[model samples]
Target chain A: MESLLRVEDLNVRYKSYRGELKVLDDVSFEVKVREKVGLIGESGCGKTTLLKSILRILPPNSIIYKGKIFFKNIEIIKANKNEIFKIRRENIGMIFQDPMSALNPFFKVKDQLYDALRYSVHNIKSQQDLQQMIIKLLKEVALSDSERILESYPFELSGGMRQRVCIALALTRSNDLLLADEPTTNLDVTIQEQILNLLRELVNKRGLSIVLVSHALGMVKEFVDKIYVMYAGQIVETASTDKIFSEPLHPYTKLLLSAVPRLTGRWKAEGLIGRLPDYVNPPPGCRFYMRCQQSNSNCKIKPKLLKLNKDHSVACWLYGDEEH
Target chain B: MKSLIISNETIKFLLKRGGSIIFTLIGLSILIFILARILPGDPARMAAGWTAPDWVIEEMRRKLGLDQPLHIQYIRWLSDVLKGDLGFSIYTKRSVTVDVLQYLPKTLELIFVAELFSITGGILLGILAGAFPYRLPDNVVRVMSYIAISMPAFVWAIILQLMFARIIPLFPAGGQLSSHIVPPPRITGSIFIDSIISGRFDALIDCLWHTILPALSLSFGSMMQNARILRMGMTDIKGKDYMVLSDALGLPLRLKIYKYQFRPASIPAITAMGMSIGADLGNAFLVENVYNWPGFSRYGVTAMLNKDLNAIVAVVLVVGIVYAIANFIVDLIILSLDPRIRRMSRSV
Candidate 1:
């Protein structure tokens, strides 16, 4: 499978009043054509930051210290304004976590979608063409009553409906890649399921390559074909979703899976001990070393991501010899 | 747009606002009337001069209807006002309405131009400052706005006059027209409009030229206030989810600022600008005197000093009415700009 997107040894830092916080350190990731990739991590673990880095949309204070993000053959970090805009307009679509705020409140659904279409698609000029295209997009997102939905402001719609509209908006300009940053995180559990199902349907129907960033291991389990478990700004492990769930390898992944509440209700859910290390002056080794129960002298050196099999990779000293 | 303007909800909103404005104007009129009456100078005695006998003052008082009880006087004034009569101005020796019609439009023109300059300039500067926050542009805007906002309008008026009118000699020192130029025939009372309407382009140019110093002085403080408000709003909005989405979507910076970001950021600035209308008019008194532009505020000030009760009352009422109307328009604009407000209005 040819890679549609690739991140090479990406290092991102945020300069704050306190210090330069290393947000993403040596973070390498890849997505193949029509592939669904999931990035699982706790909050502030650079999940969203990684997604934004791919799109080159980091905040003003952020510095891409070392990295190369390639959407196809184009290096996003080196691309000019027009090139980046074209790529964002024609190739990439993003769905934010909060549907309530992702769409602009001041505009109606029709206007927002129309703005996207007008900017991204060149042939769309006449009002009639715009309206038809908007209706078609709305229908694609499973929103019936397209006319009423088009005229209504975002606040007038329910959370589910707003998410659907956001999906439609993202699809308006995007043809290939969908960067969904916890799109269902802010929704009700039922609505979350529906949005996930809709995203699945979109991937199947349109052959879209998606990078789903979420903290819910269970949610990502049923969504993506491959999962990359992230810990402290680096991908600690990557495997097929089933493989990762069945035989979790990374210490952090094992802790994360163990942390998920069980249906049996034996009261066995224990959270991972210790908070994330301070990124301003992070440890010069594996970030999870302090928290790892099996940490030894060798853990003082940062572990390289070693491929143990065709579909499994782990970045830990324990898996270092498994590659051979 | 038509639906938004003419909807039943909008009508209800307008009616409610109109009713409130009428009541507010009435209350304001009553307050000003009492304050004017209690002021040290007696209108009748002032009208008669200090050397006049007590009998002459009494006769003057009777003629001016000041001898009547307070309630009776208020009732009479209210009834006359309801009947479209503003009564006579002893200061101008004409009907109060005529004096207002002659003077008010000039002040309004100055205010209108000043407000236009301030609002447009403020929003642009605010966008500039906000886009490059904490950078050189932002720092420059911050310092300039601080300087503009710290000074009173009249001081700016004097300084502007000295700089532009005397030092540069680019604009006239004072007055509405050059002594040599023929005044445009007064159709709408505003010299600029009347000049344009009468095809006296020369007079129009001269009117704009004379207005520059006065308008600049009148605008700077409020303009800076608007800039500060819009700057703050834009900075605050920059962190909003929609703005992040806009950036991520790679919408052009211009479109993002003007279309996506501007409306939300401009709400507080618009509200501030509306309220500043009253302040601008009050400040215009000194500005008018400095320019000798023959505006309503100067007329009203002169009337107050001479205790011209009818003129003072009329001026205050006019100012109050204008302020209320300006705020009403601001509300309407905000209603259109924010759909959330529109939805609330519909629910109401």
Candidate 2:
């Protein structure tokens, strides 16, 4: 399958009052057409930064030191403003973490959707045509009260309902790739499950590609075909979801898997010990070296992401050629 | 049924706000009365003059009802106010209400023009500053607004009069119109409106030309205040997530500014406008005195200096009532603009 998006050797930095913070360090990932990929990490691991870099939505102070993001063979990092805007309008849709702040507060739902349609879709001719499209999109998101919902402001809706409206908005233009950045983080657990299931069903029905970013291993484990475990701004391991869950290669990945609580298991839950390395002046070699129990003098030099099997890749000395 | 419910809500809103305004006006009347009495010079003595004998001063005090107890005087003044009698101006010897009616329009006209200048100029400058913040245009606006805010209205009035009237010879230095031209027949009592109604184009031109310096001077502080408020609001709104959504969706810049940004950012500016109206009216006193403009503010100054009790009270009451009404209108506008406020009102 052809990849829909590819990010290569991406490094991002944020200039703060103290100094430059290295946010993303040589991160590389890919999403194939109609594939469900999950980016799993603890908070501040640069997962959201990676997603934003792909969309070119990083804050004004952030500097991209060296990186290349390609969407369907077009290098977005090198693209001009108009070209990037066209690509974002036509190809990519994003669902933010906080639905309340995502939508404009002063505008009615229908007005916001109308603005999206006028820019994204070219075939919209009249108000009636736009209204029909919005109604259909809302129904697809399982919101039956389309008319009332369209007239109401964003603040008037419940959190779950607002998120559904946001989902409907993302799907308005039939986007090829959807970036769900912790889409269920602000919702209740029951609503989170419903939204997850809804997303899974939509992806299957429409053959949509998605990159779901979350810190919850259990949530990402349920629907994603592939998972990338990131720690301190670097991808530690990438593998098929079942393979990673069954046997996590990187030590950080193993600790993460152990952290999840299971009802009937011999495993004793334990969190990864130690804080994230300060990004302003991170340590040389592996970012997780201070917390890794398997580190040796050989681990001082950073290990490259090396392929172990056809479908599994790990970036640690344990997975190096000498070990095999 | 919907219309009836809406009307009912309107009535309730009016009663609540109106009751508060009325209470405020009464409190203001009492305060102004006490303060006027506390002023050093006695109105009866001032009217009788220093050379007048004790019996003459006593006769003047009796005629003016100044010999009564303070509470009795307050009740008498309140009854007279309720009966539509504002009493007589000690200086002009005309009814206080009549004198106010003549001078009030001049001050109102000045305030109206000043407000027009400030609101339009301030909002535009604010939009420019906010849209390209930290850029050249924003830097220029910031420096200019700072200068405007720091200078008093009287200083601005003097500088403008010197520059435009004396040095540049562009406009008249003082007064509402040139002494040679007779004003148009009074309809609304505002020279601009009266001239337009009577179809006196020359008078209208002269009236507007004369207002240029005074109006600019009067509006400078308020303009700066409004610009600062709106710029702050817009800068804050620019960072909101919705703005990010707009950029990601590729919405046109003009549409984004007008539809998405301007309304929410303008709420603070609108509220500032209401508060500034009362302040501008007060500041008009100094501007009017500097320019020698015949307005209610000039009358107020004269009344206070000459110890004209009735005239002073009348001016204070009018200003208080105008301030209250301006706030009431602003509240309605806010209610319409913000749904949160409307919801709050409903709960109340």
Candidate 3:
């Protein structure tokens, strides 16, 4: 399958008062055409940073040490401002964590969506066409009262409604790839399920690729085809969603799976012990060495991500001798 | 239908705001009346010279209604004020209301021109400072505004007069216009407007030339304050999540700043503008006095010094009304600009 997006050896650092914090260290991943990928990690593990780095939207103090991000054969890392803008407008759409803050408070829903449409899609000809398109998009998001929703400000809407509007906005220009950075983090469980289902339906119907970043392990399990387990700014494991759940290779992945509370009486939940390594002065070798129950003397040397099977890979000394 | 709905909303807002403003003005009128009466010098005694006999003073007090009980005096004053009778000035013997009207236009013209410059120039400088915070332009504006804010309007008036009028000789030193130029017919009483009505270009030029120094001096502090407030607001808005979203959507820089950022950020700054206007009116006393411009501030100051009760109360009432109205307008602008406020108000 042709990859829609590929990131290679991406290292991102942030200048802070203490020191240079290594946020994304040699991160490598890929999203194939129409594929749904999930990046799962604990808080402060640089999952959101990876998504931001792809869009080149990191804060001013952030420094990209070494990386190559290719989107549809275009090297996005080397792209100029105009090219980046065009790429963001035409190729990629993003749904932020907080829907309330994402939409401007001062603007009506219609005006905000109109601005998004104006910048992202080039084919809009007139005001009437624009309105029609907006109404149609709202309908796609299952917003039946499109006129009222469009006319009202974002503050007037419930959290679920606002999230739906945000979804509609992301799908406005028919973007090829949608980057959802914890889209359901600020939502209730019921709304989270609804949003996840909506995203699944949109991806299936539109044949759009998605990279969903989430901290919740169980939430993205059914929606995503592939899962990349991240720890301390590194992709510790990558596999088909079924394989990651059934026979997780990395210790961190295993720890995470064990931590998920089970309803059945047999399996006991075990929380992962130890803290995330301080990015300012991370360990010389394996970042998870302090917490990994399987860590050995060999972990002092960094282990490369080795393919165990056609659909499974792990970055651990335990899988070091595995064949690609 | 939309226009009808909007007008309905506007009317509701106006009625609510007007009720509060009227209440404030009434409270202000009473306060000013009490304060004016409690002033040091006796108005009746002052009206009569120092050598006047007790009978003369007593007769003068009777004529001015000063001998009446405080409540009767207050009631009489309030009733007369409600009827648009401001009474007569103790020193000049001119009707207080007419005197205020005659001198009011000069002060209004000065304030109008100053505020026009202040609002436009302040917002522009603020946008520049905010957009490029910590950059050279921002640094320059910060320094300049600091200087402007630190120096009082009177100090600015003196320095401006010295530099522009004395050394450069660019503008007139003082007064409304050149003494030699025959005054224009007093249609609105404001020299700027009256000169234009009378089609006297020379007089208009002279009026504007004389106004430049005083107006600039009067507005300097207010303009600086406005710039600082807006700059702080812009900086705050810049960090907002919507700003990032706007950028992510690939919206143009100008649209992001002006349409999205400016309106939300400007609420505090715009509200501050009303207070700035009131402060400028107060400062006009010093500015007008320094420049020898015949304005309400000058009249008010003279009345205060001479303990002219009627004139003092009249001037205070006008200033209070103007301040209250300015606040009301600012509230309306805020309601229009902010949807959150509108929603809150609507729900209430």
Candidate 4:
């Protein structure tokens, strides 16, 4: 399958009062057409920043220090804000975590959707066309009583209803790629399951190249084709979902899998031992060295990514040692 | 059913949170009484003289109803106050209602002009400033607002009078109309309104021209406040996920500000706007007096200096009532605009 979106060796930084905080350091990932890829990480692991950087939505102060994000065949890193905005609205659709807050508070749903249509649609005829497009989009999202939902404000709708409205609006132009940032994490368990199922259906139906970011890896496990486990602003492991979940390579992935509670049986799983290492004054060699169980001179010497199997890769000395 | 719901909500609000303003009124009234009592000059002595005999003082005091116990006096004043009789001003020998009515229009005219610039102009400037936050317009507004907010209205009025009125010769330093212009029957209590009503374009022109300096003086500060508030609100709002969502959705600039930022952000700012307005009115002491404008703020300053109890009380109450009403109207607006606040008030 052809790669629909590719992020090559991306590094992002935030200039704060303290210092230049390295948020995303040398992170590379890809999404193929009709492929569902889940980029999983804890909070402050730069998942949202990474997604936003791809969308070119960071505020004026933030700096994408190095690397390029290619959408289709074009490099967006050198693109101006107006150029980026034009591409993002028409070709790339994004959904935020809090659906209710993520939709404009004051505007009616139809108005918001119409605005989206105006940006996405190259040629427009009349008000009737806009209205028709809005109604059709609302129906597409599986919202009941399209007209009613269209007229209502964000405050009027329930959480799940609002999320669907957002999704419906996002899917109005039927874009190629969707960047979902922990879309189901804020929702209740049942609602979370429904949203995940909906996303899975969307991937299957729309042929969207989705880069789903989440801390809750379990939610995206069944849906995503591939998984990238990130730790301390770098991808520690990348594999097919089955390979990664069944037999993870990285020590961090092992810890992550062990941390998740099982649904069926009693599993005495100890959570990851320590907190994330500070990014500003990060440890000299390996960022995750302090927390790793296997501490050695080789471990102190930072290990780069190595491919073990056809579909799996791990950035650990154990893999490097085993390979040699 | 909705009417009942509204009235029930109003009743609950009045019974609960409304008590605070009334409590404020009572507390402020007591402070007024004490301030009057503790004042070195006695009403009788000041009205008469030191040599006025004890019998004369006693009789004069009795006639003025100053012999009653403080609490009883306060009760009579408060209750009669509820009946809308604010008592007669001893110095002016005029009913407080009539006195207030006489001066109310002038104060309101000044307020109207001030509000014109402050509310509408401020909103425009604020929207502009917010749209281009940290940009040239944004930075200009930031500095200008700081200046306007920091400098009192009186300072602006004086400086504007000195600059535009004196040097340029476009507008008068003071008064609502030109001295040569004889206003017809003061039907509307506002020169501009009366001019429009009478089909006098020249009068309207003259009135508006004369009002320029004071209104500009008043509005610059207010505009600064409005701009600052809007900028803060816009900055805060831009931080939200929804703004980015709106960006991804590709909403227009004007629609974003008008629909999204203005109402939600403005509701909070308008609530606090009453104090600025009331202060503008009250602080018009120097502006009114300097301009030789016959607004009640001038009367209030004289009353304060002369220790005129009735005049002082009347002025205080008028200022209080203006503040109270402004705040009430703001709340009403907030309740309509944001159902969240209304629901919170009802639930609480």
lDDT of 2 by residue, B277-312 (tens): 999999999999888889999999899889999999
* Candidate 3 lDDT by residue in tens digits, A107-171: 88988999899887569899998989898899888899998998899999999999999888788
Query: Docking quality tier of candidate 3?
Result: medium
TM-score of each: 0.93, 0.95, 0.93, 0.90
* Candidate 4 stretches greater than 4 Å from native: A122-132, A145-148, A295-302, A320-324, B1-38, B49-56, B71-85, B342-348
lDDT of 3: 0.88
Off by over 4 Å in 3: A266-269, A272-274, A293-303, A321-324, B1-10, B346-348
Q: Give per-residue CA lDDT, model 2, range A133-245, as digits (tens).
A: 88888988999998889878899998899999888777754468888989999999889999988888887888889999986678899989999999999998999999999
Quote the TM-score that chain A achieves in each candidate: 0.97, 0.96, 0.96, 0.94
| TM-scores for chain B, listed for all candidates | 0.95, 0.93, 0.95, 0.88
Error of 2 at A244 (Å): 1.9
Q: For candidate 2, what is the DockQ?
A: 0.64
Docking class of 2: medium
What lDDT does model 4 reach?
A: 0.77
Candidate 1 vs candidate 3: which has greater DockQ? 3
- Arrange candidates, best DockQ first: 3, 1, 2, 4
Top DockQ prediction, candidate number:
3
CA lDDT scores, all candidates in order? 0.88, 0.87, 0.88, 0.77
lDDT of 1 by residue, B173-212 (tens): 8998988889999799999889999999999888888888
Native-contact fraction for each model?
A: 0.72, 0.54, 0.70, 0.57
Candidate 4 lDDT by residue in tens digits, B180-291 = 8878567757676777888888878887787777777766776678667866777788777788787666666666777766776776567656667887887777778667
Q: Evaluate model 1 with DockQ and give the value.
A: 0.68
TM-score winner: 2
User: Whose TM-score is higher: candidate 1's or candidate 4's?
Assistant: 1
